[model samples]
Target chain A: MTTSREIRLRSRPQGLPAAANFELATVELAAPGPGEVQVRNTWMTVDPYMRGRMNDVKSYVPPFQLGRPLEGGAIGEVIASNDPSLKPGDLVQSNFGWREAFNAPASSVQKLNTHGLPTEAFLGVAGMPGLTAYAGLLRVAALKPGDVVFVSGAAGAVGSLVCQIAKLKGHKVIASAGGAEKARFLKDEIGVDAVIDYKATGDSAAALTAALAEAAPEGIDVYFDNVGGGHLEAALNAARPYARFAICGMISMYNAEAPVPGPANMALIIGKNLRLEGFIVSNHWDMMGDFLKELGAWHAKGQLKWRQTVREGIASAPDAFIGLFTGANMGKMLVKLA
Target chain B: MTTSREIRLRSRPQGLPAAANFELATVELAAPGPGEVQVRNTWMTVDPYMRGRMNDVKSYVPPFQLGRPLEGGAIGEVIASNDPSLKPGDLVQSNFGWREAFNAPASSVQKLNTHGLPTEAFLGVAGMPGLTAYAGLLRVAALKPGDVVFVSGAAGAVGSLVCQIAKLKGHKVIASAGGAEKARFLKDEIGVDAVIDYKATGDSAAALTAALAEAAPEGIDVYFDNVGGGHLEAALNAARPYARFAICGMISMYNAEAPVPGPANMALIIGKNLRLEGFIVSNHWDMMGDFLKELGAWHAKGQLKWRQTVREGIASAPDAFIGLFTGANMGKMLVKLA
Candidate 1:
């Protein structure tokens, strides 16, 4: 038997989540049963969308139940297997995160062929976040040549990739992030044309609007929104006629106790002839093959770069998840477990 | 020479416009000079979109200059012609509205081919409003089979047509209008599946949302937004996953002194995967052939019904235009200027 430490939901969060909402529990894992495999988790992912699952409301995915180990993307190694399809010492990916290890049916996990990439890369740049940026920018926003893109949360996992993709496609990119450090990373490391340090100037809609106007004098042709609230309003004000907005996520409003008032300039959508579309990456898995092909080429060419803010173990998973709201992570927020 | 009476923009409006914002002027019309034609106006249109031109700011169309005659859709008979393309007593359409008579170059007007339809119908069902309903419902909203549609301002010109087209295409339509009269017209006369009388319910977002929930229990797939504000919020609340919104006009906020707050549930767009798109009919003239073809057949089969609120002569033109805001019209609002 192997002892595994896992985090369970102690209670649902009302607004901003706290570490107290989570409880760490230890579980005993037995040897693999028939057609089963035993795995030891190496890395796990904590995403903004997971916040919605914590609520009891019905949404695209069912809400996470109380007193249960939270589920998410995980990368692990199959240490033992009873099925012929899997062997010892094989890397695998599964949705059994928030735990140190587990035994599950072989069918529940996918064998990973890293193809010279790091094992954790499957949990970040080469995984769901990468596919999200690709699908949102190219398909949802219907990006065209010469289209200028404005991205909010530009230092985060999905948004950082969005900025790079727009630049790679030969479009001007204007990025917005919370602080001076993230702003510098966006401008210097990501090579974005313009960076708005929303933390420095203040996160008010007026501040963002002024910064956007100075950055893109003509106007933005596309807006990829990861942070809502003032960022959405700023994008509306800066949108040119016939602009397209891809609503990927709204991390800013996720913790609100009540519904927040939307952009005051919503009427501009009509006068400016804009199209605002929202999408989830799960519904767009059909594009994964194309995304992997393109992203693989870019990755091999050293054209794609990413950062990770990692917590040490499964015990710190809740802290890593809560840090996302406070801008504690510059790129993908992850938990490192062995 | 003939003396013609016209309405001019005396000043810009601050909020809801008053009669004092307009000025009545008399201009002398001369005989046709070279390629110019003399036309005696018969019917003129007073549309909600005209309110945008009354402001000082630049828009899709130039602002109506103070001390200048207001321009809109007008039908007239050419009394004399200097060009071979037109002749005496030829029916024509031009943008020289708000005037009883005008002398303009023949190239400035489109010669009318009424095809057994009333000449004034050229200004309503056969003109921009009809095409707006077609393009907005079919193309902008991308209505699909089995999609439940929700239309706001269902008693107005463009919205009434949208409700009818959705029904004709074998979709369930839930309509919202003002008062018992318009509600009756929508349900009994227009044959809609459900009706919500916004005026009777006090025009609150909560009222509309409750009514929409009761009407479309399965949730709406498409939202045709003619009235913004509370109606927009209601649509967002009642939208299903991947719902589409065709924003044609926002007559409710056209005369506001400041920008109105948008839908409070704006974040729902991300969770529901909704799409909100704004459009102008003028940019979609390429679809005119398809619209006229479809609308012509519906009109001929008596499948479409409409009502007009008419104010006699050029002197009452301002009254007709202002009446639109007060829910004084059921369908097309017109001025008989002959």
Candidate 2:
């Protein structure tokens, strides 16, 4: 038997989760069972969607059970295997997060094709966040060439990839970031046509509208919404006829104590002939092969870029998740648990 | 030369439009020039969308210009024609509405194929509202057989057709209307599985949710939204995973003095993986032939039914339009001006 440390949900959060909401528990793991493999986790992802899972409400993904280990995207190495499919030393991915190690059926985890790239890339640009941006812009938003696209939370994981992908596809990209540093990263590094510093703006919606008017004078054809509320209203006001909005994460409202009121100008959806569709990355697994092919090619060609904000150790996972709502991370926020 | 009586928008309304905001004016009509025809109006249509035109803001349809005649679907007979395609006594459809008669280029008027049906049907069941329902369901919502559909404003022009069509497609239908009379029409005449009288419940959203729970115990797969605001909230709360929402209209918020807050629980879209798309019927004009063929067959077989509230004469057109906001009309509202 071996000892392993895991972060477990202690209680459901009211709004923003505190340290008291989670407990770092030590567990003893027995030898791998039939068709099972023992994994030593290297890296795990903490995302905005995980915030929703912390709540007890029913959602697309099931809520995190109290006193049980929190689950998310994790990349690990197979240390021992009772299954023929996964052997020792194989790098695999699974939804067994906030833990130092885990033992699961081999079928539940996937062997990663690192392809000479860093294994951590699978948790950032080449994983769920990357696929989300791909499927969202092309499939959901129906992005056409030359479409002027505005992406909210552009310095974040999915939003950053969306900006790069839109730019590479010959569309003019306008990106919004929470801070000046993040704004600089988008404009200077990501090569976005325009960058709006949302933190500096007194009225986010009004400022977003004014900035969008100058950046995309013809009006936005597609809006990739990662932040909802005022940003959604701004996009609605600035959308051209037949504009398409890929509704991804609404990180802005995830930690609100009270129910956040939606965009006041939602009637604009009818008048503007807009299509706003919400999607989950898990539902678009079929697009993974196509997404990987395109994204891999782009990465090889030096057309794609990514960054990571790491929170060391499993104990800090809760703080890392809570940090997401405050815009503390510049890119994909992850917890390294070796 | 001839004299015509017309209703012009005297001024833009602040909240709900009133009689004083319109002017009954007499205008001189010129005889048909080359390729022009003089039309004597017979029947005209008043619709909810016209309320948007009363505002000075830009929209899918152009705003009704102050001191100018309002335009909408009108059926008339050509009295004089300079075009070879149109002859005297031929019934045609034109957008020159709220008028007793008008002379326009023959190219601007479409000769209607009455096909032994009432000429007035061209303004209701065979026209824009019918097409709105057809394209909205099959194309926008992607209604699959056996899906449970909930339609708001169920006895109105677009909503009534939506309910009937969904039922014909082998889907269970839940319809909501303002009064018991309209609800009865939906249940008995329209063959909906359930009916919700919105007026009976003071809290529209709560009532709608409770009624939907009882009607569609499995939850709604498709929501055809003709009324937004609280109804939208109910649909959001009651929608199942991967539900599709075709946002055809938002009559509830059309005349709001201040911007109404959207559904507080719109975050449900993300959890349910919902697709809420707003579309205009004019954009899908290519589907007209298919629409007419299907709708005509249904009408011929007597599987489809429609009711019209006729406000006699062109002078009553303003009142007819105002009545739409109050849910006074059961189906398509029309104005008779023979």
Candidate 3:
């Protein structure tokens, strides 16, 4: 029997999750079944949307059950396989994460083709996050030629990609993030036209509104929303007539124990003629091929860049997941396991 | 010279408007100029949207200037004309309301066609409000064949037409209004599938959510938002995946002294994949021809029905406007000034 350590949900979170809400457990793996493949995980991702799955509620995806190993995206190498498709030592990707190793049907996992980039890029830049940014900015918001793009959480994985894509399309981009480091990274590395450090002012509401106005004097045509609360309000305040907003995620209110208030100026939506739409990346897999091709070209031209903040070992998985809420990672936050 | 009595905005209201904010003035009208026509007003409209014009803030339409006659849709008779396009006694419509008589360039007003409907119908059922409902339901909301529609302010001008049009297209409709009389009108006259009296229960938020759930057990595919706040919150709670909301107006928040809190569960927009869009009718005039054509067919076939709450003379215009907030009238509210 092979031994594997996996993290299980100890309890459902009340508000902000703590490490105690998780428990590390060991499982014994038998030989692979008929269509199953034995795999050892290398890297896994922890994202903000995972918080919603931790609760006992009906959503697009099923909630994570208590005392069960958590599931997420992971990159692994096949150890042994009974299936003809995947061979031993072949790298693959699957939704069997939070564990050192797992046994899943070969059909459930996809063979990894790195496309000349690192394997972890499949978990982030060139993977889900990349597709999310591309679909949201291009299709969901219907980005046009002269659309002034405004993105919240600008230094994060998906947001940075949105800014870069808008810039690539020759549109003026305005970005907002929390810390000084992120602001600098957005300005110097990503080369965004303007940056709003959301944490710099006493009255965050006024500051964000004024900062966005200064960034785009006329108004934003498209808003790629990641951080909702104040950012959504500010976007509404700064939107010109017929602005379109792609609502991707709201990391700011993910941990709320109760319902939080929405933007106060929602009535402005009618007078300003704005459209706000939300979408999940899973519902838009058709765009993956186009995304990968464009991303490969951008990568080859050295115009694409991404950063990783990784925590080592299976035991540190909970910390990596918790770090997302505290803005501990500048880009993609991942856990390395072997 | 002809004498005419008119109402002007004396000052902007702080919260809900009162009669003291208006002044009745006497104007001495000169003879028709080279291209001007002298019109004696017959009927004018008092809509909920006029409340937005009472504020000094900029919006889709310019704010009503203090010490000037408030401008709105009015049907009148040209008593004298200097332009060849119009003749004496020609029925016409112009944005020259809150007054008994006026002289304007003949080209500025359209001679009423009436389409075999009453002259006042041009200001209510067959006019701007009718077009608003048609364009908002068909184009903005993109109402599909199987869409279950929910309408707030279902007894009012725009919303009642939305309910009727959806019903005419053979879709199930759920409606909400304030009082028992409006509820009866919605159920008996409009033939909606369900009605929710928003004032029926003690906890309005819970009541609206439950009512909508019971009304649409499978969940609503489209929401026509005429009243915002609690209604919007209820719609979000009960929205199915890929639901579309065409935000026509928000009567609930128009007279606010300060910005009111928006829906507390706005994050649902992402998980539920909801689309909320706002629009102004003036921006959608291109849809007028299509709307009037459809409306004429429906009326000729005896499938379309409308009601009017008439307030007599120019002096009652302010009360007619104020009564909209207090739920004094159902269906199309108009001021008759012969």
Best-fitting candidate, scored by lDDT:
1
- lDDT of each residue in B1-338, candidate 3, tens digit only: 98999989999987778999898999999999999999999999988888899898888889999999998999999998989999988999999988999999999999998878999998888999999899899999999999999999889989899999999999999999988888888899889999998878422566789888899999999999999988999999999999999999888888888888788888899999999999989888999998998999999899997888999989999888888988787889999999
Ranking by TM-score: 3, 1, 2
What pairs collide in candidate 2? none
Question: For model 1, how does the per-residue alpha-carbon lDDT over A219-271 read when each residue is reduced to its tens digit?
Answer: 99999999999999999999999999999998999999987888988878888
TM-scores, all models, native as reference: 0.98, 0.97, 0.99
**Which portions of model 1 show Cα errors greater than 4 Å?**
none
DockQ category of candidate 2: medium
Model with the higher TM-score, candidate 2 or 3: 3
Superior candidate under lDDT, 1 versus 3 = 1
Error of 1 at A176 (Å): 0.4
Candidate 3: TM-score? 0.99
Best-to-worst lDDT order: 1, 3, 2
* Candidate 3 chain A least-lDDT 10 residues: A198-207
lDDT tens per residue, model 3, A122-155: 9999889989999999999999989999999888
Q: What is the RMSD, in Å, between candidate 1 and the native fold over all Cα?
A: 1.1
Model 1's number of clashes is 0
User: How does candidate 2 score on lDDT?
Assistant: 0.90
Candidates 1 and 2: which is better by TM-score?
1
Candidate 3: segments with Cα more than 4 A from true spot: none
Put the candidates in DockQ order, highest first: 3, 1, 2
lDDT of each: 0.93, 0.90, 0.91
Clashes of each: 0, 0, 0
